[model samples]
Target: MIILTGVGDVKTAIESLKHGAHDFILKPVNVEELLIAAERALERRELLIERREYQVTLERRVEEATRDLDAAYTKLQDTYRATLEALGSALDTRDVGTQSHSRRVHGYSLSIARTHGVPGHQLEDLEQGVLLHDIGKIGIPDAILLKPGPLTPEEWKIMRTHPEIGKRLIERIPFLRGAVPVVWCHHERWDGTGYPRGLRREAIPLAARIFAVADAFDAMTFDRPYSRAISFAAARTEIHRCAATHFDPAVVATFLSIPESLFEDIRRRSLEP
Candidate 1:
């Protein structure tokens, strides 16, 4: 339907533009011209509305896709972290006597790394390495690992294979490859006397070196079947004594400088049985 209105020449044209009217005729009107203009105006309005709707729909879809991508990314991160924790737990469970050993080693290693000013990324690697350091023990025969007495020469040979076993196990998992060196070499000594390659001094990976100190400290201070747990003071002395032999001298020095109270607290927390 075509509608036309005019108060005067100028006002009539202004009103048509402002109100988006179909058409306006002068005092002498032409019905045919008005009808044509009305049809064209309505068609243009429909096209504009459709274009706006299309744009809005496109934006909505883009937002939804972005949300989906974000959700997937979050799930991936959660899965990776859970998998790491589970692997650590699995290794721990394999050794019934060492129930919370992995967790304690992780905490102690990070603490030592922090005290020694290890770099951020390196510290993270150290933590992961320490948590899974003994994972290779899983491959060893239960008789050797759970023996009531000291291992015989042949049993010791079999037991010493764990580092390689652990390294191989972790290397197969892509995310854990960075931690394999530490897992493989944590048993190595600073003076070139330890096993699984006998990598010594600076030749050993720094993460492994750091973990070695933390692992030994925990081992010495914790009660085992063959020995009683030592005092923090004794543990400190032993760490210092082994500085240049079993442990990196600099790392041991740094560890000694850490307050005794800290080690005591860690020991207490770890004993939450």
Candidate 2:
């Protein structure tokens, strides 16, 4: 502020100064001093304008960078899922009679997890885990993996090692690291009788727990060479009966609560070409 007054005392000048007066000019103000004060104020105003513009530009740049990061993250996720799908498809072909089973199981597990209130970020890992749950079969001999009859005790021993094999296969991959638990522990029982590692109850990762129910449901409901397909109702009854023994009771409840129509829808979509 520039104060121009015809009469003023030291006290008034001090008060004006305190009130933010840039210049206090008495009557007969010098033209040169007035011009200098006006120039200084204009210069200060320009500096403030420039500062504001700079801040606005900086904010805009930050917003643009944030958007770019989000897009890149989305693309990376897509790539990861595509890779998992390709790997799953390859495994399915080798297993025989299980075509599209992984896809169906993926849908079921994701639904069960969402209904169970699993965090959004972990859902992707869960999906990947479900799709690749049998990845370790790659390490097994074709003779054992493709056997038409029930596996012998020796073959079963070799078969169970597939989970360990799967862990070794994926644990080193940075993106698949979160999914290792499901691959390694999907066969574990809620009663701690599960193989490889005896993780039981809450000691098991929630993703693996949710996956166990989904996998068993798919296996029971879908036809495989060794087993005839059962009705969804029958499968649900068996699943419910096994709660707290083969499946986590809480996860079983969540699975049972999911609308049957949704499960049918996921199954229908999974069969599409």
Candidate 3:
């Protein structure tokens, strides 16, 4: 701005300049001096406007670039999920009667986790962990993994290494690192009798504890080559009875609180093409 003032105090000129005045002039102004100051002030105003417009344009471009990056990230994440799902499906099909088991257990574990108050950000990790809980079975021999009857002690010992194997497999991937706990500890028992690490009670990660209940429940309620499927109520009763031994008591309670209908719905949806 250009300020024309009757007061010629040096302090007044300085103050006007300090208050964003481009030029300060006395009232007995020379027309040529006044015109020159006016031009300078107009130029300064134009420059300020241009700077503001440039900043706005720059911000708009940044926002657009950020949105594009976000879209690319989301697509990449979806592709990873699809690849993992295919791997999980492959693992499930390797067994004699466990087709869709990974998907069913994934849904069950996620529901129980949500009801148990798992944080929203961690749910993706939980889902990946549950779907790939048995991924280590890929390392097991077909003879033991697909045995029509009960496994012998030696076979059982070999089979129990799958959790560690799965852990090793998943931890190597940066994005899947969050899922390592569940893959490694899902077979662990609350009473410290489980395999690989024998993590007990609260020592076991909550995601692993949650998966234990869901996996056992799915096993009991689903038909296998060695056994027939039981009613959901019966499976729930069995799970409740085993709480604090085979499963986390708190996770068991949360799993029980979920409606049986929800489990059925998940199962039906998993079967969809």
Candidate 4:
């Protein structure tokens, strides 16, 4: 932007500079000065361009890292889902007559959770909680768990530990930690008479409250050794009667709001391979 002219005109030099000229060379240009000014301008432009390029590259790297993290997290969630399914299937094999109880309850609980606006990872956690709620029974003595007769008061004490046991077993598992509340509190009654912690009413987590209703209905309508299978309608009636006492009244109301056909469909699916 330097203006090289024959005259040593101060006014012209000032005008050239006002119009963005970097320097004004006199009639006989100082070759060294011209070279230095041009070099300095190029250096400043190069630095600015390099800085902008670095910023763009840095932004791209950060975006890529975010995408990678999200993909890895999604993969982790899928692995946990598979592991939990295997555990539920294992329970079916280990316990006689439970065949699809875990799966059924998982389906039922997921339905209820969705109705209450719970979704995504929270829904997944609730499913795991309900499916593995009885996993602690695995630790109970065969004499107590497999006993055909009613458990004695002492035996009941041992049976009750399953919730705590279940909680302890999976406490170390990162994926199952969100499920611990349901696993520990599912057996707690609305009236606070239920086992382990005796937590009542709102003291119970909503996930567990939702689960209790699903578990009861599934147990009654499904075939098991201790009871003959009852009709789904009959199971609904029994649950409705127990509302606010054995189950959360709000949860029962919501549970009943779901179409009976949906419950029937879930039951039918549970029967499939």
Instruction: Give the winner by TM-score.
Output: 3
- Candidate 1 displacement at residue 107 in angstroms: 0.6
Cα lDDT for residue 174, candidate 2: 90
How does residue 25 of candidate 3 score in lDDT?
Answer: 90
Residues 66-136, candidate 2, lDDT per residue (tens digit)? Answer: 99999999998898788888888789989978989888999999999988899988997898788789999
Which candidate leads in lDDT? 2
**Taking the tens digit of each residue's C-alpha lDDT, what string does model 4 give over 1-273?**
667888788888888889977677776878898898788767877888999999999999999999999999999978877788778878877776788888888889999889978868788778878778888888998788778777899999888999999999989888678889888998999999997899999999999999999989988987777888898899999999999899999899889899999998998898898
lDDT of each: 0.81, 0.91, 0.90, 0.87
Question: Per-residue CA lDDT of candidate 1, range 1-273, in tens?
Answer: 344554657866876677766556554567777667778878988998999999999999999999999999999978876676667777877774666777677777788889888889887677677777888888898888889788899999999999999998889988778788789998899999999998889999988888888888877877777777897788889989999999999989888888878776776776685
Clashing pairs in 2: none
| Every model: Cα RMSD to truth | 7.0, 2.5, 1.5, 4.5
- Candidate 3 local lDDT, 70-110, one digit each (tens): 99999998998898889889888988888898889989988
Candidate 1 wrong stretches, greater than 4 Å: 1-79, 271-273
What does the lDDT come to for candidate 3?
A: 0.90
- Give candidate 4's error at residue 146 in angstroms: 2.7
lDDT, candidate 1, equals 0.81
How high is each candidate's TM-score?
A: 0.71, 0.90, 0.95, 0.80
Query: Which rank order by TM-score, best down to worst?
Result: 3, 2, 4, 1
